[model samples]
Target: MDQIDLDLLATLEADARLSFAELAERHGLSKTPVWKRVKAMEEAGAIRGYAAQLDAAALGFGIEAFVQVTLQSDAAERFEAVVMAHPAVRRCHATTGAGDYLLHVLCRDIAMMDRLLRREIARMPGVVRTETIVSTRTVKDRHSLASAAKALGKG
Candidate 1:
């Protein structure tokens, strides 16, 4: 995408709830073009559906932990099955570093986290070891496309 498209995406990423007119005004464009560009971006899969970022603590999930999991086996099918079954795993990534998978989990409390680890996650086939680190503080947490773009040297 060109600079204008990138700029438009940046503004929208910051606040997807903004009106079309507002976006157009921010980008110094007419409403029609802004609407068309946004539509095109959406169709292209660059602009995914917007979502509200809620606080886990306020939602009854008082504990946040990053669990590093090591698997005895590296079979993709088995790993996919285990990861897909657990809804508490907010995000899971197959890594290239020391651990095979890193899972971001949200739980109601320490007890809940321990329960999930011992029962669900630890019991999964091929799991060799698990390391859990509870989040004491979140310095930065925002799912914005503009931040990604800037990181990639597009902004």
Candidate 2:
């Protein structure tokens, strides 16, 4: 993407609540082009819908963890179904490292996490083993393309 597009994404990352007029003015561009750029980004799947960041602890999801799961088989469809059924599994990714799936989970507490793991997670068909890494602190949490760009040495 061009510099202008990157700048627009950066501004939006900082504040998605900015009005179209405000964004246009800040970028020194007319409203029409700014609108088009934003629309194109959305159409191209670059801009997912904006969301309000919430505090997990305040929301009663006090426990956060990375749960690495190993399964008996690497069958994609079966794994997809199992992963999709668990709402507490925030982010599930198939990886080539130590485990088959890496899941980001949030729960009310350790007890709740344990209960879920026993009743919901461990019961899944073909699940072999699970290892959890509890997050002591969240140093940084961002859901923005701007952060990703900066990590990639593009921003």
Candidate 3:
């Protein structure tokens, strides 16, 4: 992607609701080219689907925790499948560290989190152990695609 593409992405990252005309105006281009660029980016998988960012607390899910999971080497796929099927698991990453997987989970309260840990995660197949860190507050949670582009020298 070129600098114009990066700028378009950055503009969209700031406000995905902007109209094609507005985007074109911001980039000093016409509507058709801007629309085509966005379409091409979408087709290329560079531009993912847009959605509103919701507050977990407002949605009645106030508790958040990072769960570090260690699984048996042989049961990785099985454990991952279980994790993927659970709605509470917002994000899961396989890592090269003390833990095999890192899970970002959300729940109604501490009690709910406890039940999830005891009833689901702890009892999952191949789960050797787990460590959970509850989040007291979220200081920053920006999805910085623009920053990423700048870091990669694309912006």
lDDT of 3 by residue, 1-155 (tens): 88898889989989999999999999999999999999999999999899888889999999999999999989999998899899999999999899999999999998999999999999887999999999999998986686688778875
Give each model's whole-structure lDDT.
0.86, 0.85, 0.93
TM-score of predicted structure 1: 0.90
Q: How would you order the candidates by lDDT, starting with the best?
A: 3, 1, 2
**Cα distance off (Å), candidate 2, residue 49:** 1.6
Candidate 2 lDDT by residue in tens digits, 36-135: 9999999998898899878888889999999888888755577679789878888898888878888899999889999978887777766788888999
Cα RMSD to native, each candidate? 1.8, 2.0, 1.2
State the weakest 10-residue window (summed lDDT) of model 1.
Answer: 142-151
**Pairing residues by index, what is the TM-score of model 2?**
0.90
Clashes of 3: 0
Candidate 3 local accuracy as lDDT?
Answer: 0.93
Count of backbone clashes for each model?
0, 0, 0
User: Is 1 or 3 the stronger prediction by lDDT?
Assistant: 3
Assess the local accuracy of residue 149 in candidate 2 as a C-alpha lDDT between 0 and 100: 78
